[model samples]
Target: MHEAKSQNISILSYLANRFDTPVMAHIAFVGINKSFLGHYVGAHEVMHDVMTKLNGTRRLGLPSRMIDRLILVFTVSCCWLAAWLDINVLSIVESFAGPAGAIILLLLPMYAVRRVPALAPYRGRISNVFVTVIGIFTVSAIFYGLLG
Candidate 1:
Protein backbone atom coordinates (compact mmCIF):
# COMPACT_ATOMS: atom_id res chain seq x y z
CA MET A 1 0.00 0.00 0.00
CA HIS A 2 2.81 2.39 0.82
CA GLU A 3 4.61 1.74 -2.46
CA ALA A 4 1.40 2.13 -4.43
CA LYS A 5 0.61 5.44 -2.73
CA SER A 6 4.13 6.71 -3.44
CA GLN A 7 3.75 5.81 -7.11
CA ASN A 8 0.45 7.64 -7.28
CA ILE A 9 2.03 10.67 -5.65
CA SER A 10 4.89 10.59 -8.15
CA ILE A 11 2.47 10.47 -11.04
CA LEU A 12 0.52 13.40 -9.64
CA SER A 13 3.71 15.36 -9.08
CA TYR A 14 4.87 14.66 -12.61
CA LEU A 15 1.50 15.84 -13.92
CA ALA A 16 1.72 18.92 -11.71
CA ASN A 17 5.04 19.83 -13.28
CA ARG A 18 3.65 19.25 -16.77
CA PHE A 19 0.39 21.19 -16.30
CA ASP A 20 0.02 24.90 -15.62
CA THR A 21 -2.17 24.58 -12.55
CA PRO A 22 -2.91 22.11 -9.78
CA VAL A 23 -6.43 21.59 -11.07
CA MET A 24 -5.09 20.77 -14.52
CA ALA A 25 -2.49 18.48 -12.99
CA HIS A 26 -5.13 16.59 -11.02
CA ILE A 27 -7.33 16.36 -14.11
CA ALA A 28 -4.41 15.06 -16.13
CA PHE A 29 -3.56 12.51 -13.50
CA VAL A 30 -7.14 11.29 -13.37
CA GLY A 31 -7.33 11.11 -17.16
CA ILE A 32 -4.02 9.24 -17.33
CA ASN A 33 -5.26 6.72 -14.80
CA LYS A 34 -8.56 5.86 -16.50
CA SER A 35 -9.03 8.34 -19.33
CA PHE A 36 -11.90 10.89 -19.26
CA LEU A 37 -14.53 8.26 -18.52
CA GLY A 38 -13.19 8.28 -14.96
CA HIS A 39 -14.78 11.66 -14.34
CA TYR A 40 -18.16 10.49 -15.65
CA VAL A 41 -18.04 7.37 -13.50
CA GLY A 42 -17.25 9.43 -10.40
CA ALA A 43 -20.05 11.81 -11.26
CA HIS A 44 -22.38 8.87 -11.69
CA GLU A 45 -21.63 7.61 -8.21
CA VAL A 46 -22.30 10.98 -6.58
CA MET A 47 -25.44 11.53 -8.65
CA HIS A 48 -26.61 8.05 -7.81
CA ASP A 49 -26.53 8.77 -4.08
CA VAL A 50 -28.24 12.14 -4.59
CA MET A 51 -30.91 10.64 -6.84
CA THR A 52 -31.52 7.82 -4.45
CA LYS A 53 -32.25 10.30 -1.69
CA LEU A 54 -34.45 12.46 -3.92
CA ASN A 55 -36.29 9.42 -5.30
CA GLY A 56 -37.47 7.93 -2.05
CA THR A 57 -39.85 4.98 -2.45
CA ARG A 58 -38.80 4.58 -6.12
CA ARG A 59 -41.19 7.15 -7.57
CA LEU A 60 -39.93 6.44 -11.12
CA GLY A 61 -41.54 2.93 -11.23
CA LEU A 62 -38.18 1.24 -11.49
CA PRO A 63 -36.22 0.58 -8.34
CA SER A 64 -34.15 3.56 -7.22
CA ARG A 65 -30.94 1.61 -7.80
CA MET A 66 -32.03 0.82 -11.35
CA ILE A 67 -32.63 4.48 -12.04
CA ASP A 68 -29.11 5.25 -10.88
CA ARG A 69 -27.73 2.53 -13.11
CA LEU A 70 -29.67 3.93 -16.07
CA ILE A 71 -28.17 7.33 -15.40
CA LEU A 72 -24.70 5.78 -15.47
CA VAL A 73 -25.52 3.97 -18.71
CA PHE A 74 -26.80 7.14 -20.38
CA THR A 75 -23.78 9.13 -19.25
CA VAL A 76 -21.33 6.47 -20.43
CA SER A 77 -23.11 6.35 -23.78
CA CYS A 78 -22.84 10.11 -24.13
CA CYS A 79 -19.18 9.93 -23.19
CA TRP A 80 -18.54 7.34 -25.88
CA LEU A 81 -20.50 9.36 -28.43
CA ALA A 82 -18.52 12.47 -27.64
CA ALA A 83 -15.30 10.56 -27.98
CA TRP A 84 -16.37 9.09 -31.34
CA LEU A 85 -17.47 12.50 -32.63
CA ASP A 86 -13.97 13.89 -31.96
CA ILE A 87 -15.41 16.94 -30.26
CA ASN A 88 -13.17 19.96 -29.76
CA VAL A 89 -12.92 19.59 -26.00
CA LEU A 90 -10.40 22.39 -25.63
CA SER A 91 -12.81 24.84 -27.23
CA ILE A 92 -15.59 23.71 -24.91
CA VAL A 93 -13.29 24.17 -21.92
CA GLU A 94 -12.15 27.57 -23.09
CA SER A 95 -15.72 28.77 -23.50
CA PHE A 96 -16.64 27.67 -20.00
CA ALA A 97 -13.44 28.96 -18.34
CA GLY A 98 -14.58 32.56 -18.01
CA PRO A 99 -17.82 31.80 -16.18
CA ALA A 100 -16.36 28.89 -14.24
CA GLY A 101 -13.37 30.97 -13.16
CA ALA A 102 -15.60 33.71 -11.87
CA ILE A 103 -17.75 31.26 -9.94
CA ILE A 104 -14.82 29.36 -8.48
CA LEU A 105 -12.54 32.29 -7.68
CA LEU A 106 -15.11 34.84 -6.59
CA LEU A 107 -18.65 33.63 -6.04
CA LEU A 108 -17.92 30.40 -4.16
CA PRO A 109 -15.74 32.03 -1.53
CA MET A 110 -18.32 34.74 -0.93
CA TYR A 111 -21.02 32.08 -0.70
CA ALA A 112 -19.03 30.14 1.86
CA VAL A 113 -18.37 33.25 3.90
CA ARG A 114 -22.06 34.05 3.92
CA ARG A 115 -23.45 30.58 4.61
CA VAL A 116 -20.82 28.76 6.64
CA PRO A 117 -21.06 29.14 10.37
CA ALA A 118 -17.30 29.03 10.74
CA LEU A 119 -17.14 32.09 8.51
CA ALA A 120 -19.98 33.88 10.23
CA PRO A 121 -17.66 36.51 11.64
CA TYR A 122 -16.72 37.60 8.13
CA ARG A 123 -20.28 37.63 6.83
CA GLY A 124 -21.80 40.83 5.40
CA ARG A 125 -18.38 42.34 4.76
CA ILE A 126 -18.19 44.92 2.01
CA SER A 127 -15.49 42.87 0.29
CA ASN A 128 -17.89 39.97 -0.06
CA VAL A 129 -20.48 42.21 -1.71
CA PHE A 130 -17.90 43.68 -4.05
CA VAL A 131 -16.50 40.30 -4.99
CA THR A 132 -19.97 38.86 -5.56
CA VAL A 133 -20.93 41.76 -7.85
CA ILE A 134 -17.76 41.29 -9.87
CA GLY A 135 -18.36 37.57 -10.11
CA ILE A 136 -21.93 38.12 -11.32
CA PHE A 137 -20.75 40.73 -13.80
CA THR A 138 -18.07 38.41 -15.14
CA VAL A 139 -20.54 35.55 -15.58
CA SER A 140 -23.06 37.85 -17.24
CA ALA A 141 -20.46 39.25 -19.63
CA ILE A 142 -19.35 35.79 -20.65
CA PHE A 143 -22.94 34.67 -21.29
CA TYR A 144 -23.76 37.86 -23.18
CA GLY A 145 -20.74 37.43 -25.41
CA LEU A 146 -21.70 33.83 -26.09
CA LEU A 147 -25.29 34.72 -26.98
CA GLY A 148 -24.68 37.95 -28.86
Candidate 2:
Protein backbone atom coordinates (compact mmCIF):
# COMPACT_ATOMS: atom_id res chain seq x y z
CA MET A 1 0.00 0.00 0.00
CA HIS A 2 2.65 2.46 1.04
CA GLU A 3 4.91 1.68 -1.90
CA ALA A 4 2.01 2.41 -4.21
CA LYS A 5 1.38 5.78 -2.64
CA SER A 6 5.06 6.54 -2.79
CA GLN A 7 5.06 5.66 -6.45
CA ASN A 8 2.04 7.88 -6.87
CA ILE A 9 3.97 10.84 -5.59
CA SER A 10 7.27 9.82 -7.08
CA ILE A 11 6.73 11.89 -10.19
CA LEU A 12 5.77 14.95 -8.20
CA SER A 13 8.76 14.62 -5.96
CA TYR A 14 10.95 14.04 -8.97
CA LEU A 15 9.58 17.16 -10.59
CA ALA A 16 9.99 19.14 -7.41
CA ASN A 17 13.63 18.22 -7.50
CA ARG A 18 14.01 19.93 -10.87
CA PHE A 19 11.45 22.72 -11.13
CA ASP A 20 9.21 25.11 -9.24
CA THR A 21 5.79 23.99 -8.02
CA PRO A 22 3.76 25.66 -10.79
CA VAL A 23 5.68 24.23 -13.71
CA MET A 24 5.63 20.84 -12.07
CA ALA A 25 1.90 21.15 -11.70
CA HIS A 26 1.57 22.16 -15.33
CA ILE A 27 3.53 19.17 -16.45
CA ALA A 28 1.54 16.95 -14.13
CA PHE A 29 -1.65 18.20 -15.68
CA VAL A 30 -0.33 17.67 -19.17
CA GLY A 31 0.87 14.20 -18.33
CA ILE A 32 -2.37 13.14 -16.74
CA ASN A 33 -5.52 14.55 -18.35
CA LYS A 34 -3.79 15.06 -21.69
CA SER A 35 -6.65 17.32 -22.63
CA PHE A 36 -4.23 20.18 -22.90
CA LEU A 37 -2.32 18.28 -25.53
CA GLY A 38 -5.59 17.99 -27.36
CA HIS A 39 -5.42 21.68 -28.07
CA TYR A 40 -3.29 20.66 -30.98
CA VAL A 41 -5.23 20.49 -34.26
CA GLY A 42 -5.78 16.71 -34.26
CA ALA A 43 -4.94 15.74 -30.75
CA HIS A 44 -8.60 15.58 -29.73
CA GLU A 45 -9.60 13.01 -32.29
CA VAL A 46 -6.57 10.91 -31.52
CA MET A 47 -7.39 11.03 -27.83
CA HIS A 48 -10.88 9.85 -28.59
CA ASP A 49 -9.54 6.84 -30.43
CA VAL A 50 -7.11 5.95 -27.68
CA MET A 51 -9.79 6.35 -25.06
CA THR A 52 -12.22 4.23 -27.03
CA LYS A 53 -9.73 1.45 -27.49
CA LEU A 54 -8.81 1.57 -23.80
CA ASN A 55 -12.42 1.54 -22.73
CA GLY A 56 -13.18 -1.41 -24.94
CA THR A 57 -10.22 -3.27 -23.54
CA ARG A 58 -11.52 -2.74 -20.04
CA ARG A 59 -15.04 -3.56 -21.00
CA LEU A 60 -13.91 -6.78 -22.58
CA GLY A 61 -11.78 -7.64 -19.58
CA LEU A 62 -8.46 -7.12 -21.34
CA PRO A 63 -8.19 -10.11 -23.62
CA SER A 64 -4.71 -10.98 -24.80
CA ARG A 65 -5.10 -9.23 -28.12
CA MET A 66 -6.26 -6.08 -26.40
CA ILE A 67 -3.36 -6.33 -24.01
CA ASP A 68 -1.00 -6.45 -26.95
CA ARG A 69 -2.69 -3.44 -28.47
CA LEU A 70 -2.38 -1.62 -25.17
CA ILE A 71 1.28 -2.48 -24.90
CA LEU A 72 2.13 -1.38 -28.42
CA VAL A 73 0.11 1.79 -28.27
CA PHE A 74 1.48 2.49 -24.82
CA THR A 75 5.05 2.27 -26.08
CA VAL A 76 4.49 4.28 -29.23
CA SER A 77 2.47 6.83 -27.30
CA CYS A 78 5.31 7.30 -24.85
CA CYS A 79 7.72 7.90 -27.69
CA TRP A 80 5.40 10.39 -29.30
CA LEU A 81 4.63 12.20 -26.09
CA ALA A 82 8.28 12.27 -25.19
CA ALA A 83 9.21 13.67 -28.55
CA TRP A 84 6.43 16.22 -28.48
CA LEU A 85 7.13 17.42 -24.98
CA ASP A 86 10.82 17.59 -25.69
CA ILE A 87 10.09 20.10 -28.39
CA ASN A 88 7.44 22.04 -26.48
CA VAL A 89 8.97 22.03 -23.01
CA LEU A 90 12.61 22.83 -23.72
CA SER A 91 13.88 19.23 -23.75
CA ILE A 92 14.50 19.05 -20.03
CA VAL A 93 13.13 15.53 -19.57
CA GLU A 94 14.59 14.13 -22.76
CA SER A 95 18.08 15.39 -21.88
CA PHE A 96 17.73 14.33 -18.28
CA ALA A 97 16.20 10.84 -18.54
CA GLY A 98 16.36 10.03 -22.26
CA PRO A 99 14.74 7.07 -24.05
CA ALA A 100 15.60 4.55 -21.37
CA GLY A 101 13.55 6.28 -18.73
CA ALA A 102 10.71 6.86 -21.14
CA ILE A 103 10.65 3.16 -22.04
CA ILE A 104 10.79 2.11 -18.40
CA LEU A 105 7.97 4.46 -17.58
CA LEU A 106 5.93 3.08 -20.44
CA LEU A 107 6.49 -0.44 -19.13
CA LEU A 108 5.61 0.34 -15.51
CA PRO A 109 1.97 -0.67 -15.91
CA MET A 110 2.92 -4.06 -17.29
CA TYR A 111 5.36 -4.42 -14.44
CA ALA A 112 2.66 -3.78 -11.89
CA VAL A 113 0.15 -5.97 -13.64
CA ARG A 114 2.49 -8.91 -13.96
CA ARG A 115 3.41 -8.66 -10.29
CA VAL A 116 0.15 -10.26 -9.35
CA PRO A 117 0.33 -13.89 -8.31
CA ALA A 118 -1.37 -15.85 -11.03
CA LEU A 119 -1.88 -18.82 -8.73
CA ALA A 120 -4.33 -16.78 -6.78
CA PRO A 121 -7.72 -15.81 -8.09
CA TYR A 122 -7.85 -12.44 -9.83
CA ARG A 123 -8.60 -9.40 -7.74
CA GLY A 124 -9.83 -6.54 -9.85
CA ARG A 125 -9.31 -3.82 -7.27
CA ILE A 126 -5.67 -4.50 -6.59
CA SER A 127 -4.91 -5.05 -10.23
CA ASN A 128 -6.50 -1.72 -11.07
CA VAL A 129 -4.34 0.14 -8.59
CA PHE A 130 -1.08 -1.25 -9.89
CA VAL A 131 -2.04 -0.75 -13.52
CA THR A 132 -3.06 2.81 -12.76
CA VAL A 133 0.33 3.55 -11.27
CA ILE A 134 1.98 1.97 -14.27
CA GLY A 135 0.02 4.25 -16.58
CA ILE A 136 1.08 7.28 -14.61
CA PHE A 137 4.72 6.31 -14.54
CA THR A 138 4.81 5.42 -18.21
CA VAL A 139 3.50 8.79 -19.38
CA SER A 140 5.42 10.67 -16.74
CA ALA A 141 8.51 8.90 -17.96
CA ILE A 142 7.78 10.28 -21.40
CA PHE A 143 7.23 13.81 -20.15
CA TYR A 144 10.08 13.42 -17.75
CA GLY A 145 12.30 12.24 -20.56
CA LEU A 146 11.18 15.15 -22.67
CA LEU A 147 11.21 17.87 -20.01
CA GLY A 148 12.86 16.69 -16.87
Candidate 3:
Protein backbone atom coordinates (compact mmCIF):
# COMPACT_ATOMS: atom_id res chain seq x y z
CA MET A 1 0.00 0.00 0.00
CA HIS A 2 2.89 2.35 0.70
CA GLU A 3 3.85 1.72 -2.90
CA ALA A 4 0.52 3.18 -3.98
CA LYS A 5 0.50 5.50 -0.98
CA SER A 6 -3.16 4.67 -0.39
CA GLN A 7 -4.43 6.39 2.74
CA ASN A 8 -7.26 3.98 3.39
CA ILE A 9 -5.86 1.83 6.15
CA SER A 10 -8.90 -0.41 6.04
CA ILE A 11 -8.39 -1.01 2.34
CA LEU A 12 -4.72 -1.67 2.98
CA SER A 13 -5.41 -4.29 5.63
CA TYR A 14 -8.10 -5.71 3.39
CA LEU A 15 -5.65 -6.23 0.55
CA ALA A 16 -3.25 -7.96 2.90
CA ASN A 17 -5.84 -10.30 4.33
CA ARG A 18 -7.18 -11.12 0.88
CA PHE A 19 -3.68 -12.03 -0.19
CA ASP A 20 -3.20 -14.39 2.74
CA THR A 21 -6.50 -16.27 2.75
CA PRO A 22 -6.17 -17.97 -0.61
CA VAL A 23 -2.74 -19.24 0.29
CA MET A 24 -4.00 -20.58 3.59
CA ALA A 25 -7.02 -22.21 1.99
CA HIS A 26 -4.83 -23.77 -0.65
CA ILE A 27 -2.37 -24.92 1.98
CA ALA A 28 -5.16 -26.64 3.84
CA PHE A 29 -6.49 -28.47 0.79
CA VAL A 30 -2.98 -29.59 -0.04
CA GLY A 31 -2.41 -30.91 3.49
CA ILE A 32 0.33 -28.44 4.36
CA ASN A 33 1.97 -28.41 7.77
CA LYS A 34 -0.05 -27.20 10.74
CA SER A 35 2.35 -24.40 11.73
CA PHE A 36 2.28 -22.83 8.27
CA LEU A 37 -1.49 -23.16 8.14
CA GLY A 38 -1.90 -21.49 11.52
CA HIS A 39 0.38 -18.61 10.61
CA TYR A 40 -1.41 -17.73 7.39
CA VAL A 41 -5.08 -18.39 8.26
CA GLY A 42 -5.01 -17.03 11.81
CA ALA A 43 -3.32 -13.89 10.58
CA HIS A 44 -6.30 -13.16 8.36
CA GLU A 45 -9.48 -14.56 10.00
CA VAL A 46 -10.06 -11.28 11.88
CA MET A 47 -10.12 -9.42 8.59
CA HIS A 48 -12.37 -12.08 7.03
CA ASP A 49 -14.78 -11.17 9.82
CA VAL A 50 -14.55 -7.48 9.03
CA MET A 51 -15.19 -8.09 5.34
CA THR A 52 -18.19 -10.17 6.37
CA LYS A 53 -19.63 -7.25 8.37
CA LEU A 54 -19.22 -4.64 5.64
CA ASN A 55 -21.00 -7.11 3.39
CA GLY A 56 -23.64 -7.45 6.11
CA THR A 57 -24.91 -3.94 5.39
CA ARG A 58 -26.74 -5.30 2.38
CA ARG A 59 -28.54 -7.48 4.88
CA LEU A 60 -29.64 -4.16 6.37
CA GLY A 61 -31.39 -3.45 3.02
CA LEU A 62 -28.70 -1.81 0.92
CA PRO A 63 -26.53 -3.48 -1.72
CA SER A 64 -25.51 -0.15 -3.20
CA ARG A 65 -24.83 -1.51 -6.69
CA MET A 66 -23.75 1.88 -7.96
CA ILE A 67 -21.00 1.99 -5.43
CA ASP A 68 -19.94 -1.42 -6.66
CA ARG A 69 -20.09 -0.08 -10.22
CA LEU A 70 -18.08 2.99 -9.37
CA ILE A 71 -15.51 0.81 -7.68
CA LEU A 72 -15.33 -1.40 -10.76
CA VAL A 73 -15.21 1.50 -13.15
CA PHE A 74 -12.61 3.15 -11.01
CA THR A 75 -10.53 0.04 -11.27
CA VAL A 76 -11.03 -0.31 -15.00
CA SER A 77 -10.31 3.33 -15.70
CA CYS A 78 -7.42 3.92 -13.32
CA CYS A 79 -6.24 0.34 -13.26
CA TRP A 80 -7.06 -1.65 -10.18
CA LEU A 81 -7.27 0.53 -7.06
CA ALA A 82 -4.71 -1.91 -5.73
CA ALA A 83 -2.58 -1.43 -8.83
CA TRP A 84 -2.48 2.37 -8.87
CA LEU A 85 1.09 3.59 -9.15
CA ASP A 86 2.87 5.84 -6.70
CA ILE A 87 -0.40 7.50 -5.74
CA ASN A 88 0.00 10.04 -2.98
CA VAL A 89 -2.06 8.92 0.02
CA LEU A 90 -2.42 12.41 1.43
CA SER A 91 -3.23 13.89 -1.93
CA ILE A 92 -5.81 11.18 -2.55
CA VAL A 93 -7.33 11.74 0.90
CA GLU A 94 -7.32 15.47 0.40
CA SER A 95 -8.94 15.01 -2.97
CA PHE A 96 -11.83 13.10 -1.43
CA ALA A 97 -11.58 13.93 2.31
CA GLY A 98 -10.44 10.45 3.43
CA PRO A 99 -12.56 7.46 4.58
CA ALA A 100 -15.55 9.49 5.75
CA GLY A 101 -15.30 11.19 2.42
CA ALA A 102 -14.56 8.02 0.52
CA ILE A 103 -17.55 6.29 2.10
CA ILE A 104 -19.79 9.21 1.24
CA LEU A 105 -18.47 9.04 -2.28
CA LEU A 106 -19.36 5.36 -2.17
CA LEU A 107 -22.86 5.73 -0.71
CA LEU A 108 -24.14 8.86 -2.41
CA PRO A 109 -26.04 6.87 -5.03
CA MET A 110 -27.93 4.36 -2.90
CA TYR A 111 -31.38 5.71 -3.69
CA ALA A 112 -30.74 4.95 -7.35
CA VAL A 113 -28.92 1.56 -7.13
CA ARG A 114 -31.67 -0.12 -5.18
CA ARG A 115 -34.59 0.96 -7.35
CA VAL A 116 -34.62 -1.53 -10.22
CA PRO A 117 -37.03 -4.48 -9.85
CA ALA A 118 -34.47 -6.88 -11.28
CA LEU A 119 -32.32 -5.51 -8.52
CA ALA A 120 -35.38 -5.08 -6.29
CA PRO A 121 -34.93 -8.71 -5.47
CA TYR A 122 -31.84 -7.41 -3.75
CA ARG A 123 -34.00 -5.01 -1.72
CA GLY A 124 -34.77 -7.57 0.91
CA ARG A 125 -33.16 -6.99 4.29
CA ILE A 126 -32.32 -10.64 4.18
CA SER A 127 -30.07 -10.41 1.14
CA ASN A 128 -27.92 -13.41 1.92
CA VAL A 129 -29.20 -15.22 -1.15
CA PHE A 130 -29.54 -12.21 -3.46
CA VAL A 131 -26.30 -10.49 -2.58
CA THR A 132 -24.56 -13.82 -2.82
CA VAL A 133 -25.48 -13.85 -6.49
CA ILE A 134 -24.48 -10.21 -6.88
CA GLY A 135 -21.24 -10.89 -5.05
CA ILE A 136 -20.53 -13.87 -7.29
CA PHE A 137 -21.30 -11.79 -10.35
CA THR A 138 -19.01 -8.98 -9.27
CA VAL A 139 -16.13 -11.21 -8.32
CA SER A 140 -16.29 -13.33 -11.46
CA ALA A 141 -16.51 -10.24 -13.61
CA ILE A 142 -13.76 -8.27 -11.90
CA PHE A 143 -11.54 -11.26 -11.41
CA TYR A 144 -11.83 -12.47 -14.98
CA GLY A 145 -11.50 -9.01 -16.47
CA LEU A 146 -8.69 -7.92 -14.21
CA LEU A 147 -6.81 -11.07 -13.29
CA GLY A 148 -7.91 -13.99 -15.43
lDDT to native, each model: 0.76, 0.56, 0.49
Best by lDDT: 1
Q: Against the hidden true structure, what lDDT does model 2 obtain?
A: 0.56
Model 1: per-residue Cα lDDT at residue 103:
89
Residues 51-97 of candidate 1: C-alpha lDDT, one tens digit per residue: 77777655655686687778978887987898788676555776898
Model 3, CA-based lDDT: 0.49
Candidate 2, residues 52-123, lDDT tens digits: the string is: 677686785555565556656865787598766544332343455555564465455455555757623434
How big is the positional error of residue 10 in model 1, measured in Å on the Cα after superposition?
22
For candidate 3, lDDT tens digit of each residue in 64-148? 5644554446435653454466455455544444434423433333333566556565454544445545555554554464444
Ranking by TM-score: 1, 2, 3
TM-score to true structure, per model: 0.62, 0.21, 0.18
